[model samples]
Target chain A: MPAVSMPIAMSELIVRLQQESPIPMDAELRCTGGQLLALVGPSGSGKTTLLRALAGLVQPRHGYISCSGETWFDSAAGHYLPARKRRVGYVPQHFALFPHLDVLHNVMSGMLHRAPETRVAAAHDLLERVNLAGLESRKPGQLSGGQQQRVAVARALAREPQVLLLDEPFSAVDHATRERLYGELAMLKQSLSMPLVMVTHDLREAMLLADEMCVLHRGRTLQTDKPLELVARPVSADVARLVGIRNIYHGEIAGHAPEHECTQLRFGSIVLKTPYRPELVPGSRVQWVIPSDGVVFHRRDRPSHTERENQLQGIVDTVHKLGEITRLAVRMEDEDRSLLWLDVPSHLARRNEIAEGVTATVSLTVAAIHIIDSTS
Target chain B: MDWQALRLSLLLAVATTVLLLPVGVFAGRWMAESNFRGKILLEAAIATPLVLPPTVIGYYLLVGMGAHSPVGVWFTELFGRSLVFSFSGLLIASVLVNLPFAIQPAQRAFESIPQDVRDAAQCCGMTFWRSLWAIDLPLAWPGVLTGLTLSFAHTLGEFGVVLMVGGAIPGETKTVSIAIYDQVQSLNFEGAGSMSLLLLLISLGLLVFANVLGRYAGRLHAYRNV
Candidate 1:
């Protein structure tokens, strides 16, 4: 009924929410100022809901959201701040610009609490930052998709919020516009000191823009780590798949080959040497993944010593040329549905004769074959 | 024409339009945005005046606000006068009868406002009232114009409900339509014809104005999607 205690003074944003019905989720997330955390999940995976919860739009059934020494929500204390009170900068999907207002007034709308005399100059300054200075008089309907997106960004930043939340902000734009916005956002990120959380389904976009990625699947946070780390060594198979890791396989922990400084894993009787995972005792079954970049296509013309390291011979089941790059799905002779996807330059693919039904061997480096401790 | 009745009709129509604007907006927005099992029942209740005969609604209003009824007694106690056959009583009856005309178009317009825009307004340090003024009202201005115009025109031409509830009081409740009926009964065909033609022309003018506002709003809506 009342708040008697003081809000905990902290620098980072701490959000742990539990909600039932309408996307039923349980998640705990943390992001410090100047850090960008990407929420990566498939549709219906509750990524948007989580972002809305952080914005104070969706009230969580339990837990608290604290940011920069202020408590935004705490279900335990029945202290839930309204969306407007949170002072969160949220750029919703499609940019959602006020259709009636011109670009300058739209940005000014976010500065309602500021003095009227100071608003015009500040709004103009924001428009300049967004590269929309000359387009101040233009309505949202008149501007291009990219310009509209910038207006949304300027409006969000006008409030000087403690946190910035972007819900698929670039989704409405064309490829060319999205690419431009990506660069703009990267530059904008340099000026922002608040915790910025972006929800994106694109793993590549997440990796490009975010300092950290939190992978969500079916309302649960499966993992949170640096983009490359999440891709290279996911904590679980679900996380491995969510991060777009293509070569996940089942294996058993064979004895550690300490003399060679590698751990041996039995992939259906084939002993694969991986970076030392000594904590996994012999005979423990595990799941592991390697990125497509790690899957090197061995060449018959020039055989190397490392080519023999964890080299598995397979017949190329599929060969797809993706622009200058070619993807070959190599099916191991002894396994089923176990396609090791290998990327090769188009000219190299031609020289190596990597095509469907052709026999090929690829090597997995000891460091690349990362064994996940949990599969759940 | 009975100019006193014509002036009274204009006064009543203006009051009704002003009174019902907020009511229409509230009901229209709620009906447009909310989804519930009871919503259909609420919608049907608001639509009663559209299907029922004017006298039937007028009869209910008369009874509901008669001297013995709770509302009638309460009004008499507060205002020191009988509720029936008064301007205030007539205004209530007109508002009730025009609910559908004022609310339906506004509801349709509010329904078309993109949900994302409303959510964005909430996150942009805006209170609900601020968003209503800056976002909802501007976006739905066309429908609101349509609602206000229709209700004002309808109130000017109201006859049976006004006759039943207000009983032809000069300079009080004797509206234009009732005046036209009176002229016809008194064998003043010329006066009746003049007033009828005038009502037709005013109604047409309002309708045309509404159409113009609608086109402007439509252009604005289209520009937003671009």
Candidate 2:
């Protein structure tokens, strides 16, 4: 029998799936009610599979999935709850609305658990809540991608579920629609009482909406923390790469400068200063990263204080404009071939006359430089 | 025109269509949904009627329904009669001979249904029967109708299986096709030619209906893709 009662003690979703067969995963995740937890990973990293497992759409060969104290799946005791029985609202990537049904019936279809008379009114109310009130009579195919995504969310909400799972729900929409949907999702998230787990490959998307993020790699959950921390302090070089840190490079501990409240590192052909780590022995090889936020573009017109430490002269390798910001890839003037990535406001690049094949100086914030374990 | 033969042929076609409705639906759906290792082999087996000669099917049906066969003996003990050369036997032969027409288009229709739509139906808390009725049937009804029309057209014109299983017994097994053959043999060229032309027009009409339904099913699948 499927577990129906929500335990009072089980207020949050806790999942642990570990096995080698069928979709292999060693993922464990937690999210309190009303919080949005983003499962961030690259493609084929088992992010969607993990979300499906949570929603009871995919069963792990071995695992325990519990939400609000109900044991939805426990492989040891051989307990399994099928997808429908679980109070989960899953919004698939494509927003698989019933094509034969109009938008109103599509939302009402998921309201089967509610009273018959209340369902229609409830569906109307949900459609209204999702800002789709006028489109209640339209079919899914007639709606725009953003509108379709809204209907999918409304349908999921009609279930009155304990947990909501969205699999890259806004990916199909245009960029402008995505920007609008992001704001709408942020608003909707504030009103949701259930925990929402969203799977996304874009860390920027996760950072924009998720309260906490769980970084996944090769089917294993690597780190779970606030999105900013995951970006600034990844636990290993492998995760640093996964989080899209492009400045990770080989370095060695030069020596500790206790009086300066920092430590020195031997970067390729140069010495750089970072936050003090007295525990590290000098001459030990290590991997380090500087957060993109820490990379400051130096200009002749303006003076900044922290630019004094780790000032490096590099040739701008490439410059690509992205709306208001210009993404710059700078190859440092050293034996190292790796390029450092920086995103500055578009006007900053134009004002500084920065472009490809031009020389530039940048400051790697001492406090933002992080050392990571070499082992995965 | 042998009106009794025509009437018997209409009865056989209608019976074949009605009887094969559920069989075609379930089998076609199974073929569409199943991914077992032997699925391809099973599909080929089900398609044998399309490629095999009607006489081969008729001969096998004759052998399997003879008194010495277990089915024949069991059927006789149950129904107090032999299995061959009767309207019931002809109906059975029609259904078997029309399997390909009744199943292939329907299977293609069911297969065209996006799997994610089925997943969404299940996720909506709809049971398997509910989804099949409310979702799968709605999406696949056009293809199913195509199968029925194709089967009806094919059943209206079947001759070899009818000849082998149900011999020319007027009002019992002698269908319009066999009646036309008998008319030609007796040198009644006018009667035979008129009946053949009428059958041709009816089959043409049904084929056109089936083609329209098939295209409608294709459009439904295309809409889902969009």
Candidate 3:
């Protein structure tokens, strides 16, 4: 009785695609039920292509896509379902609301097969859910950008699709409106139990709304991980940069301790420690990144009592005041003459009298030093 | 005043416009959305009527519909009459001369619709025909209307092709333009002047109405995008 009473379990989605035109797409992605996955990349990086392929708007020459136990596309089997039969709710970058249809009709347009009364009732209920309760008769052209987008979302949800795809859904609105929409989306995500995939070019947007982040570059999946993990331990320097990491240095493996599972890396004259991998042998070159938040800076006049494992003295090459934060570019006084970027609160910079010519003591915490494999 | 010639001309124009609507929409949407080999050649072929002299097209139609030709023989056997010098002959010639006017503007309208709009309609479970009816037709309505009006006006003024095929037969094949030409030949300047003025006023009104509608449609499209 308990087994029969359980809700229907949502099936996992798997997509592998390869194509060459309209911006080549070579990506493999997976998402489970109740999870929001963000596909992020630069412009022309095939993010939209991948989303379209999943929605069956664009077909790949070689691919296999299955969602909720349905084989939407399988090139090896020569099976392909058209977009009309895919049951996907896609909110394109421009929202793409029907201009001639009123808000209620736009929502009801997706429910054409249902009874007339049911479609009207469902559309009104959806409009209410999206906080557009009384504007049902207003056409999309008469509404503002945010209101139209809300109508678009309501229209998409009216069909009750198994998968929801949003392509840069909030990029069209102003920043203030985007923040409110983000909160609204977060609240909406709680009730929706389907797999949602959002394509975005903004790293902050991805970190704010997505449960997992997938970074793409040149039509290839660079890395996929939790937002924090992607920021801390990117698989490569390119991935680190794409995720907004500012501090990266070229280093070489100086020593490897098999007993302790740690590796010593040499960057110029500074020796850093990191969790070792079997592939990183001594004398091999590597690229490494240290998140700006992980770098501890102390005034040279009053040094802190923290451990000095990877301490270095450097001159502040430049100081950039960005709102409440100050970014300092430090030039190391070591043999490599490497430059390190650090972000400090503006109040702290003012209190410490940190200026472009000031000398500062910075420490690179061993646990935060991430060595990325260059082969990828 | 040759009211029968005026009525025949109006019938020919209306019939040609009504017949060209479906063909124009189909061809316009296809050319706007598709990329194929020899696309340029296909486009040029469709637009040849706009650039080539009307008499040249009339000559070809005359030869092609002559009794010796296959189409002429089939029509004669089927309808128990000759294919030349008839209202049907004038209608076909008018449609051929005005084909580009019906297609080019409609194609521009279809092309103006963003791909996202089509994709959004598809994602909503609308089939190709359903979307065309619900989204494409409505969004591109102004341009389609302009094309139809232009075709109607173009067919109303047709002289060379209709004269060649229909041969100016009074009450059966003669149209308003032929009537006006006949008046001019007989030194009846007053009749020719009145007919020409009527046509000028009608064509101007249709064009102005289409321009206003097209501008309104463009604004509507801009609002949707914004």
Over the stretch A1-376, how does candidate 1's per-residue lDDT look in tens digits?
1223333434578877777776789887888888899999999999999998898887878877888878899888778899999879999888889988999999999998799999999999999988888999988878888999899999999988999999998888999999989999999998899989999999889989999999999889888899888888899888888888888899889889777888888887578888886788888988888888887778878766573367778889999999999988998854444888878999999888777998887888778888988733
Strongest candidate by DockQ: 3
Stretches off by above 4 angstroms in model 3 are: A1-9, A256-262, A275-280, A374-376
Q: What is the DockQ of each candidate?
A: 0.74, 0.73, 0.81
lDDT of 3 by residue, A1-376 (tens): 1122223346567777877776777787888877899999899888888898899998888878877877788887789999889878889998999888889889997786677779998998999999999999998878888898899899888878889999999999999999999999999988888889999999999999999999999888888899888988999888988888888888899998768667889888767767767677789988898988888888656776444247878999989999999999899865678788989999889999999888888888767889987775
Q: Cα lDDT for residue B92, model 1?
A: 94
Instruction: Please give the lDDT score at residue A107 for candidate 2.
Output: 96
Q: Model 3: what is its DockQ?
A: 0.81
Q: How high is the lDDT of residue A200 in model 2?
A: 93
**Is candidate 1 or 3 superior in DockQ?**
3
Give model 2 RMSD, 1 decimal: 2.9
Q: What is each predicted model's overall lDDT from 0 to 1?
A: 0.87, 0.87, 0.86
Ranked candidates (TM-score, high to low): 3, 1, 2
- Model 2, native contacts kept: 0.55
